[model samples]
Target chain A: MTAGPPSLTQDEVSSSPTRCRILATAERFFREIGYQKTTVADIAKTLGMSPANVYRFFDSKKSINEAVVERLIGEVETLISRVADRPGLSASERMREIILALHRDSIERITAHPRIHEMVEAGMTESWEVCSHHVERITAVLARVIAEGKAAGEFRVADPAHAAGCIQTAILRYCHPVLIVRCPGDVAPPIDGMIDFLLGGLRAG
Target chain B: MTAGPPSLTQDEVSSSPTRCRILATAERFFREIGYQKTTVADIAKTLGMSPANVYRFFDSKKSINEAVVERLIGEVETLISRVADRPGLSASERMREIILALHRDSIERITAHPRIHEMVEAGMTESWEVCSHHVERITAVLARVIAEGKAAGEFRVADPAHAAGCIQTAILRYCHPVLIVRCPGDVAPPIDGMIDFLLGGLRAG
Candidate 1:
């Protein structure tokens, strides 16, 4: 129940050059070819280190994958928290920005580095412990905004946590990597329109 | 662009006993041994017919799978329509019943015959044309409820079709067969609470 991917602390990444070198090489191979085909041997070879040496730093290939994915999600978590905690915006405005920022970040990242996106997709489909934790953290960011809204009287929801959970579910079509890929070409409602409709519902009183 | 599964009309089912027998046998084989393992030849052997004869009715094994899956979804379609059209209920009450009925029906069917649910899961995951049409029909059923709600002053939505589409996307966690399997035993919020939150949003203002 307590299982989650271990975070690569700044001290460790900065202190251990070999571990950082392995991760950087692994990320490059994942981008150039793909995560599925990329192996720790290839990363080691690319870094001019033996595979056993690579294992000395990371326990297994799966751990390397977890670390790489965790790093990507960590960046998103940091960015979202900043937007959520920024001053001088009403809760509604902050909510809108945070949602749009997440969407834009996901779409842009996937559009730019589709191979990297594939790695993330595999992590999610495989139900990696890290991916589950990442989703919980993102939901927490939205919950923070909703709680602020309740305090400011900008939102009338009874439970901020429940409302935030519902909002995350409602917007998965727009924010989810797989759904975002499939939604654009179809006759389904536009993302902006759907978001406006949701904001309308939230603002309704 | 114009591809979709052929409909098996009641007239056809009643008129052609051989085709009906084939579908019934295929469904049984799928339930027993799984869809991935069930084959046209196996179905033919079971029915004492040639594989060629089986193909005479269904274009391919995939089509047979589609028809069988379609039959299952068609039953749901009918039940949902009945729930939507039943008399003496306010549109709000009708909407609640219809949504709950759908969630219950989907969950119960998946729970009851998990093998059959696997076939449904395959159809949805593979982007089968029949599955797309089936979802479109279900959305129409929800749209009818929303339109009635708008007309009865039970809902203030401007666009029933759009609202219905949004509702379907929002409730995929509870109603989607695959998601239902993954949701329980996790830290995610409960389905009933999420639905209550959605209903509260819908009832806003």
Candidate 2:
């Protein structure tokens, strides 16, 4: 990788250590004090930097929140991608693992860092494009597995992409942050049962 | 046809015209001014009644909201039950109609009386029991249809209740008030496609 000059472009600045530090500090503040209560100044102070310096990285708190959420969800996306690319796993097994990974990650995050939910809520409400793109990426991965399953003669779906969308939507109750928090004592079927049901759909003639 | 005396029990009072009027007026206020802003006194004033009378009917605004939500979902439960009981309709057809009705009703309510969503949100937040019971009732109706379908050799599910719960949870993205509003430009599969996919689950061996 080429070392850029001090006067870096926007993309180069994004990849710099300073940007990563700002995001990490902002995420810590969001987890500790909640997103709505945390300010850019607080993040900067925690990092021993000036507010103007932070502003140079992120124009506003909302942009900072977007970056923070992106960083958090990036971990999940990486985990899911790893599961999808695992060797010797059937499509059904991969689907199960991926769905379980998503659910487990959501539960762990919400349980371990309840305050971080505010940041996620803000991202969903204020930065919907980020959430939408995240969804599209997840759906694309699911579609790949579905297409593989169809080609393997394990699934009878005519359109892998459409079926993948349906599966993702169906599993939202188990994986969505808001739903998991809101319906703590949910009356829905367990995740395994739900997966089995959806797998039945995939394997149907 | 058994009319009670002037001193009515809680059950009898709930069926009284005055109580009905109070609920109706409260619903109107909730629709017009939103749940957080609509007070018992506002509802009482609109109905030419005392706040004490409204209190006699409903102990608090939260109670009134529970009742209002109960009444609203009562309509949906009835509609689903009717579909479940319709003559000569196959299980798949009934499921499709019920899901479509739920989606239609959600869209209509959110579109026509956007403020009414506040009351629903309040019910979900403050009176979760009412929401839980509504879910149970809907799930029960779906279970009954699934049972009938299984008996008729239309569906291949082993446990109707479990499958019903799964379907109900799966369709939440299409029917839930908060989700419909929050995901207005949702990228999920269309309702028809979702219904077909779910039917595949039910019909799969």
Candidate 3:
């Protein structure tokens, strides 16, 4: 038997029209009604089909969510790849760009469908495996950048791995109020201070 | 109305024997079986009482968990107060010690109680009100320390509130692996190095 062609782009792979429509509808439905409250009937109704037709597409509500989460994971994977592909940039510059990109993208995307993000936070316990592997993969990309930075003498960290960990921690800590914990009234300081502090730490001074 | 009497020390306050027993059982059961798996009956059985007898003291599983979390918060409050009472240390020393203490205690008392901590993470949405208040109170405690340190000339930071916020972010970032994601059999990086990096960031230099 001949092996299938392996030249499919991700868009080609996930873009089977039926899967696309189902995912689009389900993501919207899940965002509006929430994961707990959304039903197969609602998804099917939104798609102008019977509830059983929705089942034919997904084994269960959980499976549809798994697909949605997998879709999210794929987007983050692309982010990791693009940063890894930037070979000409210094490690510090690359790392800075990646961190800023994640920050800006999270804020922008989180605004469009806040509940979708909340759904991920909600399912985190139950779906930790799905989410954390993607996070670890993201971390690994930064680790590569850190190692390259250290080798080039552009950064002066004793442990590339540990420094990478610290960078991720600092970014998340700064963003938690904005994204996760819902801090009140924009009461926090600007992110530039954190960026400066991190830059200073990374430098040999 | 007359102001209420000030409470005595934890040691001096006589906790009712039944309440203590219930709390002890709750913590132990939560640790062994986890929050969702552990039932009122399981706790009652451990205490050699009928499940019905347990409800006479607490209305539901939620109330018992609330008591456990309340006790944790109370311990944290007590720790901050004790630090406030210590008069001789320079304000910088006090602030550093506070940061270190929070890092230490959270890892020891809270992280050590795996199931309770797991429940707290899993039920963050369910208990957002309680968790937010707890975080804000802790934030205030750290903010006050920074304010005192700046006033006493032990800290030269231009912004106490921002410094305090950064301190909280640093500690939370330090504890991220323990709190947000489960780290798998990986040896922890030296907290000493991490703390030095943080202090460097916060330093007047």
Candidate 4:
């Protein structure tokens, strides 16, 4: 039912694949070693660039790390934009889709690459501004869909903000796939039930 | 009424005033300066110990960091164990207590000292094994409580494994408190509701 790691889209930045390659290589190196251990020279050498050239792209190791994180998270942000831009999708449905996409990606992308994700989380260390900025943007996107759904009389909720919070937490619960659901004889809880609860909670009563 | 941070119990290594002072001072330093920046020598110098003498207690900088994290997590683990071991608390109730404790601490301690907590998470970055170990232990503790509750007919669940997974996810959701809950003018959804959802889908019947 599931396909192996889907081939990454490679044509997005045809003009600047080198920078993207550097980021990709850096992500792998960071996961294989770690953020603290991975150096700019290592990343450049892996990308076939001199450390001096890498410095031209990123002034320091922190900058390169930041760029890689920004790149991955940028993908997530694009998903938010896509969901936000979808016309004719009900707010409830929009919220559901966003939740499913996030849960699916965190499980597929993040959990599958826990070491890299941990490295990223580490680099983000203490930068609430990073987490806050990302969460707020995503939350605002959800809020928009919820408000639209409420106006359309398709949903019933006294507070879209609260609903958004509830949805975000529920979706994020899927981040640790191993702890949440082990395969083979471990009955994974039905995430569908969660979607049902959110929809039902927001339904016109 | 919520009280201030609980004093360390006799079981905690920091139960004594001297160790508490060390932890307190260490926490402040880690909070004020980055962990890597705040060296053992710096901590010792602040504590009025010679750099060499600081080694008398801690074997390494890593060891000192470990001790500090161990002390902090030790408190939360104690509360979780106590709830899990309660004579009559249902699985959901035990989970509620644990989540509330986690949420309270994350908001109070981790959030207030975001940089320190980030370092804490990052230091554990070398190995998901650290967080994974704790998650597994917590899940096992929750597993026992769920099994016992099901056996006692106080809780109805098709699978303790799945329920434990849900519980694990639900509790850790509090790890990012500020992101999950809005602070002003809007009351977030009750966390008790999340406990119920994890315990048994929307409707127990």
Best by the DockQ measure: 2
The per-residue C-alpha lDDT of model 3 at residue A131 equals 59
Q: Write the per-residue lDDT of candidate 4 for residues B53-171, one digit (tens) a residue.
A: 55544557666666676666677678778877776666567766766766776778755665665446444543344455555666677777777778777665556655665656544
* Two-way TM-score contest, 1 vs 2, winner: 2
lDDT of 1: 0.75
Q: CA lDDT of B22 in candidate 3?
A: 84
Poorest stretch of ten by lDDT in candidate 2 chain B: B1-10
iRMS per model, in Å, is 3.5, 1.3, 4.3, 7.0
DockQ, each predicted model: 0.31, 0.62, 0.21, 0.13
The runs of at least 3 residues in candidate 2 whose Cα sits more than 4 Å from the true structure, single-residue gaps closed, are A1-8, B1-8, B48-50
In candidate 4, which residue ranges exceed 4 Å CA deviation?
A1-21, A31-37, A84-89, A111-114, A126-128, A176-188, B1-102, B105-168, B175-205
Model 1 C-alpha lDDT per residue in residues B1-205, reported as the tens digit of each score: 4434444665764478898899999999887777888889999999998887776688787777888888988998999899898999987777778778888987897677667656765665554577778778988998888888777777777778888777777777667665565444354567676666555555652
Q: What digit string (tens of lDDT, one per residue) describes model 2 on residues B51-125?
A: 877777777999999989999999999888888899989999999999999999999998888888788878887
Q: What interface RMSD, in Å and to 1 decimal, does model 4 have? A: 7.0
Q: Say which prediction, candidate 2 or candidate 4, comes out ahead on DockQ.
A: 2
Whose TM-score is higher: candidate 1's or candidate 3's? Answer: 1
Q: What is the Å distance of residue B63 in model 3 from its true position?
A: 17
**Candidate 3: misplaced stretches above 4 Å?**
A1-17, A48-57, A80-90, A174-181, A185-188, B1-100, B107-163, B173-197, B200-205
Q: In every candidate, how many clashes are there?
A: 0, 0, 0, 0
